[model samples]
Target: MTTSNQKPFSYIAPGAPKVVKAGGVANLDLPILNLATNESSFGASPLVEQAIKERASQPNRYPDPASTDLRNAIGETFGLDPDLITCGNGSEEVIDGIARVYARPGDEILFSEYGFLQFPILCWRTGATPVKAAGDGLKTDVDNLLAAVTEKTKLVLVANPDNPTGTYIPAAEMKRLRDNLPSHVVLVVDSAYCEYVDDPAFTDGLELVAGHDNVIVTRTFSKAWGLAGLRVGWGYGPAEMISALNLMRGIGNVNAMAQAGAVAALKDPAHVDMVRAKTDEARNKFEADLKQFGVVAVPGAANFVLVKFPTEDTNRRAIDAHRHLAAENIYVRSNEDYGLDDYLRITVGTIEECDRVIESLQRFFAA
Candidate 1:
């Protein structure tokens, strides 16, 4: 049916459109309690708002293509060399850049079975094979990952305090993974939820990047700093890897307002600490409350909790709960696509929001 001059095109398997279940729906008749996306419920730092307002005056000019000031501020905050840092529109952009720069058409990119969904999509877009290593009880298992690696493997991505499951491996295990991977294989450690983790055993992969040339650690302002709206993220790695990413990244990828907001957000450590404390308190309370309802709350180190519901006949399955909550204008993420059919991923919201969802769940089960 195609014209002689026109070429036919189609995406590969598993390259279908993804249905993202994000929070913060607008124009609802009732007050909506959104515990779907793992965003900071406390909002961004006051300084960020001020910075954005001030930067809004210069809308006529393009942002700094190199993001010099933002990179310097990030370096100062994390004790990293500015040359080793690369700022992006978001951590997802940096991840995409990694796949584009390192993976070839036939190369393999490996991740956990339930790792961040973006990893596979990024690989598929680049014509790279996405390999999934079996997870050990919803947690990244270094042994499984090592076993899955082959000569074709070009990159490995691990999301620490991983989304949906919110589970993570310890520092020792991460080091083992890095040491075992081939020198040509780039290990990308995504620490999007690192700010919320307080476990002593957990490492954000920064130290690993310091000692290894093939390792890169990506972080985001979306989680703790509450700059998800601005879409600012940064990555730290070896100078060579940073240079490669910079070469392939779009010019002026981060806008002026986002850069200004991120710089201010980085300066305010007290604000980040406050957000972390509130998230920890709310998450702990939510898990304990879920336990009271006989729901299996998966132990997590991130800003969200995964609650496994009973079977469908009990009217407490994840799909039923999601529908019931939606009718009440309370939205939570269902994990059916992540292969966790009976579990719901609920963001750690404010105390009031948490109480509302918990009470709603109680009413759903009671009825």
Candidate 2:
């Protein structure tokens, strides 16, 4: 075993999932229809386009170090105080900030078995121990996670509507977990895909942050707002937690154009509505198709489907399917490193994109 402080980072595992690497579509020298990244195929709002274009000329000016205006917009949208909000270049940055602020050497961070892959990576960067609680059929099992907590556990991350799998813990269950967790552990709910979710029973996380000092809910423009390129995400929590994350991040984290784009994206409710409707339709079609293939598709509130492979050659099948789809200008994700080597995560795309992927799978299975 390598030491944690070994050069070139012995802590972060080399050969992490291939799917996490960039260019599922871009690298495949084919026609390139990418459904791999869980990106909004509907693209950004026109308002954001106009705002970016308007701000393009002012590249020389330094962005707001405080992110004052963007913070205000986020607070207003979520009905939180500005002091309770913290913005960063991306939510990943916020994750790092949390580790820096709360974790010290030898401290442990707890997460579900299949939570966002990045949270553990952040813990490692801070020289903290990353621990996992067993997940309940890909859904975050709050009971198991709560049991995993100890005095050494300083952070607990729950990715509601968890990525790749898309399963969500209901609001009631989350409340029970939060109410039961140790006070010393800070709870982070990464709501990256929250905007696409339709269930009223789902916890928004921000509402809990309203009164709870230990709970922090983070959101992003990357998922639903189609601002993945710009990378603007924020967290809402008690004033003290937000301030601590801010102090850890220091100044000039978010740039000027990203702030402008996010502010504009907030104003365009119609775009969000349109994408949600389309995504729901696509999800229904894809789920039905997966059933015919004898694949067990997990029910999720998010915008992607996690389908388990039937054969022992799960990794090969997924890679072949991905490669074949790229030949036909379509792309999807194969989960080898999330510890589910037998499952492939397919993002919901346009009706045409969905059909292309389904067709490619049909051909792959036929052979």
Candidate 3:
């Protein structure tokens, strides 16, 4: 007999199918009204489709290792220098790259209580320790995050308008945390949901990146651009930080089709604006509609709402509600893994999609 000491680190991935696959019925529902993944209610822009089609015949060739054209387009669109942008397969890769470059074994990577589940996985991937600060009512708490930092904390990650919970930290508060943090720690602002933000005071952290060597802002084409399948994301930061990320990035991390599609997606601002306007309208209406059932949803600026259910014990109501929706093939996000058993995160879909849930939910809550 041989004994081995090899074990893999733990990472719970998002975007798992919400179909109840245990019993045959769980997976048998048809035409799932998916409000689970925070995918854009609208699909990709026409330009992106055309751009991808233009490059479809060249699959046999290797893509540009550095994503030069894509970076140039992003730089011009956002007024950032290409030198400051590092494109990745998705913002997830950019984030993981940051962990590999900055954090070593036994080093500490810090984030908010409900920041992103991926943060822990990234830390584990780099053999770094994960430190979490308490949140303030589902929102990232700046003071708590600042208080949790220690000398060994090499990287600090904050997801503005964070996932699952969908609560955001305003620009002033975000700045306060940055100002208070020691200069040695690198702060990563994952602004995956920034385009949906209507708050004038909210920032995607570009100003912070403008001067701070220790600050980097990560963005994605997934949510607002409706390019989740394309897996295109970029980071804007100091030249040195971008350089380090590029060094750690895999060859052709952003695929050819992804690069072409993202560039095209950027050229059409009207499509994104329409998505933003429509999402805002749907979200506001969804929130108001839930109130009729005495339910309160977290006012999230993203394209999703974290709806809370009245529970007597063991989060029974929320779990039951999830199953009830599941039976009807209407899938929304269950936050049990995020320690939010009493809440379900629902993506704001089209008016028709949103309407489907209301009647079903009324039956659950009223009964």
Q: Tell me each candidate's TM-score.
A: 0.91, 0.89, 0.91
Candidate 3: global Cα-lDDT? 0.85
Better of 2 and 3 by TM-score: 3
Compare candidates 1 and 2 on TM-score and give the better one. 1
lDDT of 2 by residue, 220-331 (tens): 8887788877989888888898878888885888988999999999898788898889888988988788776676788886667888767765543666565565455555
Cα lDDT of model 3 by residue, 185-269, tens digit: 9999999999999889999988887778999999999999999889999999999999999899988899999999999998998
Clashing pairs in 2: 33-329
Error of 2 at 54 (Å): 0.9
Q: How far out, in Å, is residue 128 in model 1? A: 1.1
Candidates' C-alpha lDDT = 0.85, 0.79, 0.85
Instruction: Report model 1's TM-score to 2 decimal places.
Output: 0.91
Clashes of each: 0, 1, 0
RMSD of each: 7.9, 6.8, 6.8
lDDT of 1: 0.85
lDDT of 1 by residue, 147-177 (tens): 9999999999999989889999999999999
Q: Under the 3 Å rule for N, CA and C atoms, how many clashes does model 3 have?
A: 0
Clashes of 1: 0
